[model samples]
Target: MRFNKSIISISYMLLFFQISISILGTNNYIVSIPYLKYYFDIIVLFATISCILSFFSQTIAVKELVFIVLWLVVSAITLVTTKDILVVTNALMIISARKFSIKKTVQTVFFANLFSLTTTLILFILGFVSDNNNGTVNKHSFGLSHPNQLGAVLMVLILCSAYLFIHASKNIKFILVILNIFYLLLLNSSGSRGAILASLLMFFVLILFYTKPNYLYSICLLIGVFFFCFSLYSTSTSVYASGSILNKLDTVLTNRVRMNNVFMTNYGIKIFGQQVLYTGGSSIMYHADYAYLDNGYLRNLINFGISYSLLFYIYLISVIRKVNSLNLYSAYIIIIPMLVYGFVEEGFTSFLTNIVLLFTSILFISNEKERE
Candidate 1:
């Protein structure tokens, strides 16, 4: 069934709000009151439930439905045992894909990020945000808990800006152009090198292919992916090889390479996923029982284990096929930045990534079925 526009709009808006709050750190940015945070969480919960209900109104293959159920069951199991609620919430987003068309989903996400970024800038102007220059070139959190978090949020915004700019009406096109310039500045201020470069590259690729999609677009996407991966590998290798001169670079990652090595050595990979001690020194504490793996791919491996991660990858492959079948190459190109960013950061874990991807995935699935 076609869902009510009002409900879908509210749900998508809340989804982005939920993500903004998640990145903003419930304890610090907007409301420090415990009950207020709980109330917001409840609102987001209800919205997700509404979206899920809408999802089932449409026809779906029995096998596909079964796969979704199994995924939820696995997610619930992981949540109860590991207490990583992101697993369950992320599943909700995946289900959300069916509620709207690709263009609407893209527009919603764009507006959501716009709302988020606007609020953040206002907070920063009012001196409500943190401006801790924790030795980075620009450690402006802009209401987020960390510079990197702001960088990540802006990365998503930048991508959204690029997509919307391409598809926007003449009246809004000028605003988007100006917004793109500002987004780049924000990215720089966030002092996240990986996010900055990856975002720029994604934006550039999307712009290049904005006019039309072609068979060769797949090859172009593969090339983009290769360059991203190589850039990440080269950066990490060079930083480590530089020795003491780039000790700060190592620290910037929170010594993630070392931390990852230690954690793997101590706990090792589990077949079904298990909780371990947090390895970072972040002041904000939520689920203190499990150690934070900043890397999204590794986080999935350690949290969901090989079996579950394999299922997730399979779903991603299907989504890729759907988009490729439709020749929505720009949409396909967008996922590359996040995938590359996930290796060094928590893009896969972050709500910003999930919200954007969920909508895109739904768009692909819907388009694929139409083609058939």
Candidate 2:
């Protein structure tokens, strides 16, 4: 598997920017450097151009083009209805996924995330990033907008780290293990219950699939559904209001669940997605102006509506199936957790989600050739 240097370089650069832009576009930084957020748009543009160049160099699958068109339609709808151009970033990543094999893309993302996490840790140690205290808990934001965001990032890193650990060289394995531990600690510190559980479940499922492939695959699938529901319930405040095991774990989730209900009640299920007229709601803490739908699936419904979002989900699952066919269990380790955590996290709507999607898509197509 000869590596394309240009693709690797651009992919890593794009990923670094995708992960770091949240911190870079922080309120303080935005105030300090007006319009700094727009710089991320330039990064997206560069990534898109790189993908276009790769298209001529590499043979593209019909399936890749189909997904790309679907993503662009999504971006177009988002632009038309919400006037949000950020969807282009997501669209570009879908296209960019064709540039590398699954292994290369996974390794690159693993390293990029490691770099981002390490940078966050250094900044926290240097007092550049605040260690936030939220009444009941002391959480590390690591320069992101919120502790949950940090947890979300750590969740992806944990899965990637686990994959790397399984495949790393003897010398590299120890470091990967150490990084995994660090990621777990940060995830716990961030108090993202959904991500924590999702990561654990992903690792467990992967282990079962690897070790007991014949007996456990069906059982693991059943357990995955149960675990996913339990995780969602654990993260939702309304599900266990009686100060039960759920509340004992975390009360903030009650607020999040309530906010989710509010959106569902207010917006209802629309075939063509409705504009979110109001962003203010009970679950919002830092951003009092906008309502926070903590669930990514629900958020997708709001942004792209039922019909289009369902199309997106179908495309995503097809890619996941492709990865599974290639036996790239690590990509599953990264994506499955993200999908579960997306129930309670908002990464699906952002560039970070698309980055994962990009890699998974590329892995799907690239690995197909290996089979051939």
Candidate 3:
């Protein structure tokens, strides 16, 4: 495939803009820009249409056509039901970049996030951004909307850097140490146990992958399946019941299990997504009530509907199989952590935060020999 410099540059800029806007939107100190979301929606719509045109311009096979049609149907349903354009936009961006290498896609997302995170932290240190701790001394938002947001952003950056470093023939040990140390600091400062645990698990899995590659697949699969099932169980069960194990677990997870149960019981699951009014901890100042379902599995089922959530899980599992078949250990290692993180956070639902979703383009392409 011949490289088109103009197309590549345009796609890169579009991805950077999309990711930057998404990250900046999470910062608490930034004054809400009037009509900014509308502008974003416009750009995303234009970009998706342009990408679809570019994608169809090439000679596509029957298999590709079938997949594309199915994806479009799901995307349309998701957009109409959930009103989430970003999910569709992320997939379209990946489709648009099919002609390019996956490495380029990862690099684009990594740098964009790094830039946003650095800027936010700088402003925070300069006292230009307000640090919201939810009236607690132990937890810090670090300029983002919540303490967990900082941890989530850092986790994304760490995974991206780890993948890049592993593929670039760098000192993996040193990179792992540095990344884990940074994660520990963030954990201590922000009290984001979910992100810290996810990072630690990723680190351990990577080490095992290097030392015992033969058993790594089964281990990862088991961990992912366990988390997925646990998330479902917690969401379905009545976590507030006295003497229930889920109730104890809910306390350990800072009430995430109970919140999931509340939302699931109230809204229930649907085949197509529904509009959910999520009043998170950050909204406490504005509203008397607060409920946030941090579990990604439940969030997807409730927000995007049962069908969309199932499709996403199927896609994720297929990606894992492809990674194993292609011996893409680095990608597999990174994906496992994202899956585990989803058990406690909703970041897995968005491509801007979850790089694994972007890999769908590479894994689904006709040529299976392409290396990242």
Predicted model with the maximum TM-score: 3
List runs of model 2 lying over 4 Å from the truth: 1-8, 27-31, 214-252, 277-290, 351-355, 360-372
Worst 10 residues of 1 by lDDT: 281-290
lDDT of 2: 0.62
Encode model 3's per-residue lDDT on 1-372: one tens digit a residue: 334545555666777777787767657765666765565675586558547555634566676667666666887788898888755775575456554456776778878877887898898898767787867899997887788887887787777776777766457657655765765686568777777777777778778777886676787788779988888788756686877999988778877787777787778888988888788545543232458778888888888887777778777787777777767777766788888888888887877677777676555554445533
TM-score for predicted model 1 compared with the true structure? 0.80
Q: How many residue pairs clash in each candidate at the backbone level?
A: 3, 4, 0
TM-score of each: 0.80, 0.80, 0.88
With candidate 3 superimposed using the best TM-score fit, by how many Å does residue 355's alpha carbon deviate from the native?
Answer: 1.3
Whole-structure CA lDDT of model 3: 0.73
How high is the lDDT of residue 295 in model 2? 73
Q: What RMSD value applies to candidate 1?
A: 5.0
lDDT of 1 by residue, 34-125 (tens): 55457446634854674566564456767657766876787777777667666676666666655556666666666666776677678777
